[model samples]
Target: MSNVGQHLLSGGLSGFASTICLQPLDLLKTRLQQGDGSSGPRFASPTFTCVTIASTSARNLTVFRTARDIVAIQGPRGLWRGTNATLVRNVPGIALYMTALTHARSVMAVSPYFKAVQKYPSGDSRTRQGSVLPTLTMQGNLLSGATTRVAVGFILNPFSVLKARFESSIYAYESLSGGFMSIVRAGPSELFRGFLASSLRDAPYAGLFVVFYEGLKIETYWTSHTTSAGIHSFSAASAGALATIFTHPFDVIKTKVQVRSEARYHGLYKTIRTIMTQRGIAGFFDGVSLRLSRKVFSSAIGWAVYEGMLMLMASA
Candidate 1:
């Protein structure tokens, strides 16, 4: 396969894997973020540190309690409350990823590094080889992922507001009427919602995601030369786990900011400060276990399926 193709394969796989495996934990997190139960940020965010969820009867893992809580209040369908939003988020994220990666790979093909190697005194022998090209190409991939993620975020901010609101509160789920209008009426500055945070979070995480995925495949190629889907799965899981940690603070702020009508949190900085000073450092990582665990499963399965789908598409 072509190197560009390989990058795409990895990207698709990562996308699918992240979704399926991480979704359950993600469900719980959304419920927590929306304040579906009890008081405190635990309702708004669901910290692992919450003693209430622990002290409650009929619970083992927070996953189980999260499920019970949802079913009791909202019924079985509630389990998937924000699922469409999640899927919606992924589609654009992937579309942007594909476009960016393709462009990046193409630009770097004839870049200076490859040109230097081509004109080098030691070797014209490898003139048309892909090995030297990928080194230069990966840099392009990083740039492309970052740029496209930013561009994609603009198209997607309204949807993000939708997701946050829907997941955070039943009121949002009850009415999908506003659509983009909600965002438009949100005022010029607020339209982007958590965009800057999302952009910053997505770019580097996506870049490293590519790097780690490619590196895993290379590492496997060195030993057994297997093409297990696990490499893509694991890479995505790892990347998602890491991204969650860096981005959770912003994630919290976004939800609060998007849903607030009175501007209790003001801007991103103020929102963060409010959360920290009022709730402490642990508040920032609310629902971390659920998020991390979800990343492992969702990234693994979603990415594996998505990559397989792409290969199927390409061959067809």
Candidate 2:
């Protein structure tokens, strides 16, 4: 396969693996973010009420309990309720994001302003052991990560809306195509419901993730004089955790905007006001643990597999 093709394959495989492994966490996060209808317009559907009842009790909304409730209500497969939508969104979404990010970094690396200072030999640009991609300056990492992520995010946001609704109890979408058509019928506004909030979350999250991941790898090498896939995984996971925490509020708002039909959630400022007024400061952190867990493992597994595949392909 060509380099771009390899990047796509590698990213798709990584996304598939991570999504499958971490799907339950994603479902829980959606349910958690969906919250109770108490703060907004309540759906009249019994299914919505039932699902909300399972996780709405302040004391009973723990992740384990919510997960158990899902299994009780919809059987074991309930946890993977949105697997198809997630796969549709994440597989190509991750592939495009990775490819765009790689291309951006590669292009930037050739520019003197973004080029990494070479402290080692020239043939292989692997400044540190197990680092396969071209290293750029911190500014390069931030810019490339932010711009590429937002662009890919914008392209795949319709699928993102589908995925969010699929995971939430608010929508009873019969099929992926059906859900997609529903959004289409709702018009372009619904298709890009949370684009602004999503962009806000993704831009900084991607930028900081790259900056922290690269910085951690370099720092680890400097401190321990070693680097490997293990170190890369650690760095990526740590970076993901930090970035997830920082950007989680926007995530909550984005989920609300996409999944709920209430007028309160129809706009960014209104959603913020509703969350703060109803759920307080802690509201923004809803489902944070589940998101953190999923992001950490996903980042670790995804980046490790992506870089490893690229390295193998290059060596071959």
Candidate 3:
């Protein structure tokens, strides 16, 4: 296959594998972030924290309880409720993002302004051990990852909306097409709901992920004097954890804007205010554990599979 074709196939495979394995976590994260959809004054009062504490003591939606509830209500298959929408959104999304990143990095590698800093006399541009793509400066990595990710996120925002709503109990979207048509009828506003939050989350997350992943790989290679898929996976997972934590608030806001129809969630600023007022600081971290778990595993699997495939294809 051509290089671009190889990247497309590798990315699609990686996305599919990760999505299938971790769909349950994604669903759980959405459900937790969606909350009970009650934005009453009682939830915003100073005593609200005590009420929350008491409520949780009574019937908290812990991860295990959420999983159990889904299974009880819809069976085991319910855990993967949004798999179809996720696959449709992610397969092409990953493929395009990977391809764009590769092309961007390749272009940047050749540019005098963004070229990697040389450590040896030969001034080679090859990546360090365990990396297949051309090495560029950290700035290049950040720029390429952030720009490509946000652009792709924009293109797929509608599918993202569908996926979030599908995963939530709040929306009973019987089919992917039906859900999409509903959004279309709601106009561009609905189609692009949560896009700002998504961009905010994705840009930093993708950029920092690449920066951290590459830095870790280099450090690991230096320490261990070796490189392998295991090293790549470890690096990717570590990077994913760090980036997920830093960008999780936007994730919470994005989920709420997409999944809920209340007036409080109709706009980005309103959603942020609502979450802060009703749920306080802890609210932004809702489902963070689930998202963190999902991101770590997904990054590990997706990056390992993608890079490994490219290395194999290059050799072949």
Candidate 4:
């Protein structure tokens, strides 16, 4: 009905689609990051110049082998180990993020600075036709993205803790509810064990992603003199990839904290210290490539589908 409503619907559908298509990769990334620097799924040759934060064995690991290992250990359904928890986390998380983005842009559009600038030729034009103003300055984009993601991350951190544990060897949850109850028994605070690290990762990643994606879209729209869904997808993928590279270490620490039953890596500082002491700088970047792949693919597909659905909904 409304643009914000449309954004919420589009975000949910897009997140659902991406989660289903890429759950296996997400599983692998979590598992890889969860492993101590002795063993985990391998992605390439042992000599491929990857930082082995997983194992000292140093054996070659491939995606196929990793999938097989999962299958062998947990059956074919094992690949989707934490799918329910993931859905529980992402659907609301994405919807809220998009809604926040829309609101943030709307707020920015009416800012004194924006009103002053909009008198020029480069001003927002969507309002001319009663459409929502979508343009935002780079600063607005980064701040809004970071704020939305961090806000949503706090709401969804409980699901995140469950999902990470389900995906890791730390816990073998029989079902989503069972896992949730277990955590509740552990204590409500346990559900937010890694909230700080999660915030650190999510805020920066989301901020950078929006900065890169929107910046690229504006640049390409001007430079190429054309716009298309394909271009949007490419920009989303590029943004996701870049963001993952920068925030991946935080991801590793977050996973470590979430899945651990003990307080070994208790706080963010302790986690970083332990990682550095045990595995060095490379430890923080364990599964960087896998994470990049998942983020790029999922974000591209999700954003493309979201934008396309928004257009369709508006036209209808």
Candidate 5:
């Protein structure tokens, strides 16, 4: 198969694995971000701490309680409520993300700046005498990550909208088809309702993720401290954690904009203003910890598996 095809397969497999493992966390994060401020007793009483429905809750649910609530309400499978939509979104979303990243790097490599750098060969054998390519610059990594994330994110937004609704308390669709039909009934505009917020969140998050991950790898390689697999996973997790923290407010806004059953937010600016007025400074940071944990775990698993598959395929 072609290189792009391999990237697609590897990315799809890795993303699938990551999504399955982290779906519960993802659900919790979404629920927390969607929380409004009202709290009530859970019917099943998932845990010792307070737990409530997404729309009803003002405060974020604790991660432990969130997991328990899912089990209590819908059984263990409840945690994976949006699995189908998530898989559909992530599998191809990640494939396209990875492919775009790679192609972006290649495309960047041929730029005038890189071409100028290439004019002067490195002294290192791995980059010169041996069969190893040079690393991307920080700028290149950031640009590629942002560009790909925005492109694929926009394309796959409908799935994102569907997934959010599926996991949310807003809609109780029996099946994926039901959810799709409901969204269709809502109108085509609903699918792209949060496109601006999503792009704003995704573009910065993706850019920072690549920059930090690649930067970490560069440092690790320079230190010669571990194997490629170890470094890759570590870097991915580290990057994810940092990026999630920095861009968490955008995530909150994106979720709010995407999943509102009613038209609460007229636009991105108005949404931000409303959140600030209602929830204050803390509103934008709802579920930040949960988001960070989920992002770290998912990114680590996805990047590790993807690189491992590439290594295996190269060996084969």
Candidate 6:
């Protein structure tokens, strides 16, 4: 299959998987960010120590219980909250991330400056010649991560707004006009509350993902001699799990700003500080267990799907 087709198939399939795994959290996350605080009674602790739904109470259903309650209250429709906006935002976001990363790695490997930097004896050059590849590659890694996010944000910024608005109240999807108008009225600036930080968060995380995934594939194929699709899917899942850790705080902040524009976050700094003082560092890791599950499924399934699609398209 063509590389492009491979990416599309893997990415889309992984996205579906991730979505399913994370949907429950997405439901709770959306409501929590909107300050629903309805999970209070379910919690054993009366102090209301944290803003995350998981912190409040986890008895009978705990976070899962709250999730079920939400489903019961909102119906089956509720579980898929913000999913439309997620797709709209993530498809292009991921595309930009992966495509830019592929190009960056290729460029770093072939740069004339890097090639010239190789130290070599004419006879033994191939074996002894070390090059500036690592330095340039790291540079490429950072740039690809940052620039791609900025590029993708143009398309996804709107969806970020949509997801926030969609989950702001159940009224969001029920009344399309109101949802559209809410976003329209927020002004462009509000639509992208933490653009710079979000960019920072996405770039490194995604770049590392590319580095890890490519590296692992090479290692696995070379050592085990495995070329199976299942292996590739597993590699993708592993890379995704790693990316989730580094990028999660930004994810938390992104959700917050998108859902709670009235909360008054002037910038990433203030936003983080508020979360720390008001919610503590644990705030940065809200619903992390759920998020990890989502990422693994999404990455794994996305890889399989995207690969399968590539094979189909290439054969066609």
Across 1-316, the per-residue lDDT of candidate 1 in tens digits comes to 7645655565655555565445556667755543311233322222111222222211123557678877898897777676666666765566456646556655665677522222212343422111221343356545655677667777878777776665654333344555446556647665677777676667776665555554553444344333445554665577667656666665655665665443446677876776666566755666667766776576667555555555455545
Off by over 4 Å in 1: 1-23, 34-64, 113-141, 310-316
- CA error at residue 27 for candidate 3, angstroms: 0.2
lDDT of 5 by residue, 235-269 (tens): 88999998888888888888887765434465798
Give the winner by lDDT: 1 or 5.
Answer: 5
lDDT against the true structure, per candidate, is 0.56, 0.85, 0.83, 0.75, 0.76, 0.57
Best by TM-score: 2
The weakest ten consecutive residues by lDDT in model 5 span 42-51
Backbone clashes per model, in order? 19, 0, 0, 6, 3, 14
**lDDT string, candidate 3, 1-316, tens digits:** 8889999999999999999999999999987887633533212123111122112311157889889978997899999999999999999999999999999899989998778865222333333345677777889888988999999999999999989988877666678898799888878998998999999999999999998988887777556644568778989999999999999999999998887666778888999898888778888899999999999999999998998888888878
Residues 153-187, candidate 4: write the lDDT tens digits.
88888888878877765465678888788777777
Tens digit per residue, CA lDDT, model 6, 1-316:
5565556445555565556556656666555444422334221112112223333422123456666776787887777776766666666556555555445555665876432232223353232111111333445555555566677776567666666556544233544455556656757876666666667667677677755655564455445534346656777789879988888888777766555433345677767776777667777777666666667777677655554554445446
Which has the higher lDDT value, candidate number 1 or candidate number 3? 3
Q: Which residue ranges in model 5 land beyond 4 Å of their true spot?
A: 38-56, 114-134
Across residues 80-138, which tens digit of lDDT does each residue of candidate 2 receive?
99999999999999999998899899999999999998534456445435466778998
Instruction: TM-score each candidate.
Output: 0.71, 0.92, 0.90, 0.85, 0.87, 0.72
By lDDT, the better pick of 2 and 6 is 2
Report RMSD (Å) for each prediction in the order shown: 7.2, 2.9, 5.7, 6.5, 5.3, 7.8
Positional deviation of residue 39's Cα in model 4 after best superposition, in angstroms? 9.6
Tell me the lDDT of model 1 at 220: 42
Question: What 10-residue stretch in candidate 2 is worst by lDDT?
Answer: 44-53
Q: Which whole-number lDDT from 0 to 100 does residue 273 have in model 1?
A: 74
Best by lDDT: 2
